[model samples]
Target: MQIYPAFHIDKKITDAADEALRKAQPALKRIDEVTDYNQQKMLAAFIHCGVSESHFAASTGYGYGDRGREVLDQVYAQALGAEDALVRYNFVSGTHALTVALFGVLRPGDTMLCVTGLPYDTLQSVIGLTGDGNGSLKEYGIHYRQVDLKKDGTPDYEAIEHAVQPDTKMVYIQRSRGYSLRPSLFVEDIEKIAAIAKRRAPNCIVMVDNCYGEFVQKEEPVAHGADLMAGSLIKNPGGGVAPTGGYIAGRKDLVESCSYRLTTPGTGREIGCTLGNNRELFMGAFHAPHVTGEALKTAVFTSALFEELGYAVTPRWDEPRADIIQAVLLRTREALIAFCQGIQKGSPVDSFVLPEPWGMPGYDCQVIMAAGTFTLGASVELSADAPLRAPWAVWMQGGLNFHSARLGSMLAAQSMLEKGFLG
Candidate 1:
């Protein structure tokens, strides 16, 4: 891919960014290491499933006797190193999958402890942390509480040790940043929290919300200490290929319980139609490792470019990445708006339109999002989103290829510069 020749952006800025990327050579080399590990796991999953063309056939009527559906579950479970997995189109979104996992495990009298700070905005209502939604876990009598991260953005280990009440049935850890300034949690972080939970609340379950995090690391949170982990097919696990789905992989009993909630008690994993989705799932799985590596490289390029332009960047270029996010702090409202507009201008779709922060669902403040992806709202594709909070940072991630990511990243920098937001 041509780095600086084609984009109609400032040559001086692109030249500096090109130099910065050259300096990130060591980090780029590490992507192959991460990709190789994920490839091994994904291959094992495919081999374990003995995936074939017949598995793509759709099932109808109570979705019983669906071989594809069953094997796909096994595939995900194996990939995540879990005893079992629930892979289902029945899950409409990531939030839906998380809801099923939460409701399936905890009872009316149990407590759910969020070790990380507040969860993604969408989860607030699901947990009844805000609105008294009737179908929420809180409305169902499940108690909820969260311990915010320390000033450094790491989990407050001391707070966790103090908060693990005897009744804390589940210890929830969010692996991705989830619109927070905190860096994504690593496998070691999961292991640390898991050990504490095991000692403090022996009977409690440790679950990781493995959203934007899948495949970026050699080891998963489940391999570290998490008893269960979940993510959406439209995110990293989807490889930009899956039309729609979500997965929950973990201990057999817990997975079975989630399956029960996904379908029905007696029919657990026995039903659900693949409905011609197996092809996408299987192909997506096969492509995930390579595609994830591409995203990682794009993240590195983005971080380096933004930092070169005198902007503060989260998870700075050289840091180990647990997920695909690369946040750039524009430090002003207009800069943030221009940066998003740059992304929209660079998109393959809807390039002519402009994006502005406005009241969006599932968020308290006005937010801005830009994506010109083939798949609607796919985080695994090139996209940027940020809320109208202080520092005016925009979290940018996902590019199908280096060429696209390079062009997009340069355009964003150029936008900020033209608007005089940079030095």
Candidate 2:
């Protein structure tokens, strides 16, 4: 006998979801094709690097001559089409990896230009835009400037060309949309930005924040022209398995510099220990492409469902996706809360817990989040979150598998309907 009662999904929501799936067919096919190509690529990387069972062994303090650690880096470098890479659990977050890259390449008198306009909120403190100036880029005497995106939310190529200067040591590109409504950048966009940066400032390094953008398409930023890139492992690349980590991949010399920043200058990538996390990390890399495809499908389904329910959504069901994130504009605080609560309810873990808005450390506004992931804050699993502000948009990403993700999205809509937030 079944131990638990079957959960109810309203007929209205189910009907809407069925319609949304019909509309999402084309996008789903594209995702499958990309997944196949990326899977082959990842397999090639593993074979090329000669990944073996012995490579999964752990090392302790000092960790000298750790073969597994070295091979892990090689596999990532091959997979990302980078000359070198630093993959470590020690880096903590995507922001930390980005910070290391920034401090590694820049000097006291150098300037860093952001072509994607102001970055996400968490980066503000690192760039010295918010918080006390302690250890920020500005405090270290690195100048910062940005060329805002065009009114249509595309990069201002001409403006970027003009903005590059002799002292511009790094050109920053953010691949994900962050909390904004603008479209996330594609690898082609990164290539163009890199070409412009190299043309205007030959010595400048083109760096990309690749979070949420990996394995979505056939090519990564490094393959297209970016000199360096960084991301959190807990996102798409983690395959929802890696407990904690981040990666920086790029030109060999630049990667070495980042390694220096990650550890002490003399120690660099040579010293850190894996502490038995190697197996999960390697397994995560192997499964990343498929998991990312699942997330993309879920995002598309959510987009179509919300659109069917008469709400605005970014990168509609049939649109080409650059990342897994799906943004739904609820337009009211009550609806936003209800949608998030619904997502929490549908979660496999902590289904009964009610999520509320609170002052999250990185953001300027009170943020509400619902994540019942096995690994806390793992965005590769089904999750939804939003800041309490105007337009009331909730950014949803990750679905380890499409079936569960679709149900979670439906529950969100059902919650809104139950509360009369939907017509």
Candidate 3:
């Protein structure tokens, strides 16, 4: 088989991956061992928010009372392995959860040094970039500073330390790239950031935006000594099980504060007596590990294949994958669209439809996607997206099962071959 150029997987790594793939083939052959891809796609379509089921399910005699809070607390603790994880199906978005956490922990006039430069694209609006006529941290009087990423995409520790001020109440670190110019931050990098935060200012909160990076690494940020870790329910942590929701896990006090900020003041100590979809969130958390692992494998394989084909693959699999995203630089608008169309056809999300770039609200330019039309990011089916940029690159993410990802990848290659672009 031909290897991709951008990935730089040598003979040894390729051999190891091959052996692992062969070993897994038999185990994967059992239909009962895996969830159906089409079923997952259908589930993705209906889930609008983490609270959808709560909106529909008949109240189980558990009003927005103590019982509801207890159920939420139990579910959160079970999913995160943190004694004090705060899982709220109510938080509308991952940014909402992070904002709640930040607002809860940082007092007004307190500084929030951004250890990881600008956060995800959506968050840029929230952090006061243009205000863009939106509410954000700046509106709350939270001062912000940034430290650019290192050559390998990790944060600069010394620069972070320099940025720290006496009034710094929180140090924000984003694990996933989050629509930034930099690449993803690795687990070790997170640990290092935690160490710096602890050494320079023990009282300062160490928070991470663990969105797409959740469960992709062996150890979570909490394990690496981060004070708090937050992510979207629609992303990796949802595990194709959480119809909608996001999560925040970490130290007891901080999590408690975040819980309070998530709901009405004084209501944060417990899962607010608000109704929540406990069953779906619970199930999604249960399957998260395996689903995230499959997505990671797909990313690795796709990255390697595309790299071998002479495309520029970011976060090249020379080292362990930081997350499930594999961005292939197509360098041409025509090629990028073709690549996305092929992946979309393989997806259960509107398989017959072709995707095109169109203007989206809250963004500067038109964006394109090739999956089911839902907002909460739950499309586990294979798809690709790219912002219009010079040397245009299409970033591909997701595949509920490795088998489907493998097939999609081969089809992508076949598409390229048909266009005579592989030569």
Candidate 4:
């Protein structure tokens, strides 16, 4: 029984995006010519699971020789404008890459100012404020300070400037809201932060945690003067190709240092150079631009649909998108739970598993995840979560394949409607 009417899309939005695609046909055709379909299919399968061609290569010990590195270099140059880039199947997650970058660049006694307040939930332990003390950065003796976001979710630049100390070695800005329901920082905002870092601590490095936010915006953090930008292979950049890994891109020196940390202290990027899942990484990067664009469109569609149903959506249609995430404020725990259950039932993961609020490892409050089957925040599938906060705001993240995202959103709305959540 469908409780809500079928989704009615605004033809204007779709028409405009279609026109833009048509205008960019030359570039699209070029991308099509360079991309290998066999590799793209394999990459897509790998992203859906936890395995890929890279996993097979590594297991068989058929290393990613110099040729693989060369391919990576060419790929980075074409896609990210990075002079040098390293893609390893061993990074495991975005946080792992961030750890490598932080350890590689900041030495003991150096200070790291968290300009974005407490980063994503998982990073809390890594930055030394929480957990059982097994994380990096803080374990390496790096000090940390935070500058909280203002009422509207933007960073307080004055507070950030005030937090900079004489020994500040780096400033970290996470573009994605992570577990927080706040909106992501924009490129202009990042530029402002960079400006403040340069003026306050001239020698300090400015790094961005560019996870789910990748490719969503035209201007990357690196383009706006970020010393380094880090993200996980399973997120936006993987584009459905990388089986398991992470990436770090930035200035030549900083990337080189990260390579050293990734391998051994003395061994540089060239050292421990094993051929990673080149096929997946390469194919993923190739498809990233298209996949990301589709995901953004799905997000826009979901936002508009939810808003029409009377749910409060962040960043209305007239506003610019912060990231691909589309948050719908449910306003009550019962409604939130119903919405999540609907999403879970509609997901590609376990459809029978019902989500409930439970105390997650690092978070301060009980949290609920509706279809995040891959241990952490795996965007390869659709999922929704809500921190157990008052007013019960639910945060919906991801839309791996837009088709699945659209169906799941409709089901979610239907579920809510059945529960009398809608007018």
Q: Highest lDDT, which number?
A: 2
Cα TM-score per model? 0.97, 0.98, 0.81, 0.82
lDDT of 1 by residue, 1-423 (tens): 245455677767778777778988899899988899889889988987798888888877777888888888888878877888888876778888998999889999898999999999999999997776879998899999888899989999999999998668999999899787798988999999999999998989999899988889888888898998888888888888887888998889998998889888998888776767788887887888878888889899888888888878888889999999999888888999999889888788888878888998878899999988877888788899999998678889888776677678888878888888767
Assess candidate 3 and give its TM-score to the true structure: 0.81
For 1-423, candidate 2 gives per-residue lDDT tens digits of: 111247687777778888889878988999999999999999999998899999999999988998999999999998888999999988789999999999998989888899998898999999999999899999999989999999888899999999998668889999999888999999999999999999888888999999999999998999998999999999998888899999999999999998888889989999988899999999999999999999999999999999999999998888898999999999999999999999999898998999999999989999999998888999999999989998899999999999888889988998999999888
Clashes of each: 0, 0, 13, 2
* lDDT per model vs. reference: 0.86, 0.92, 0.67, 0.71
Alpha carbon deviation, residue 229, candidate 4 (Å):
1.0
Q: Which residue pairs in candidate 2 collide?
A: none
Residue 235: error of model 1 in Å? 0.6
Candidate 4 structure quality by residue, lDDT tens digits, 262-347: 87756566544444456777677766756665566556656666766677887554356656676888888889888998888777
Arrange candidates by TM-score, descending.
Answer: 2, 1, 4, 3
- Candidate scoring better on lDDT of 1 and 2: 2
- Of the candidates numbered 1 and 3, which has the greater lDDT value? 1
- Candidate 4 — what's its lDDT? 0.71
Predicted candidate 2: what Cα RMSD to the true structure? Answer: 1.9
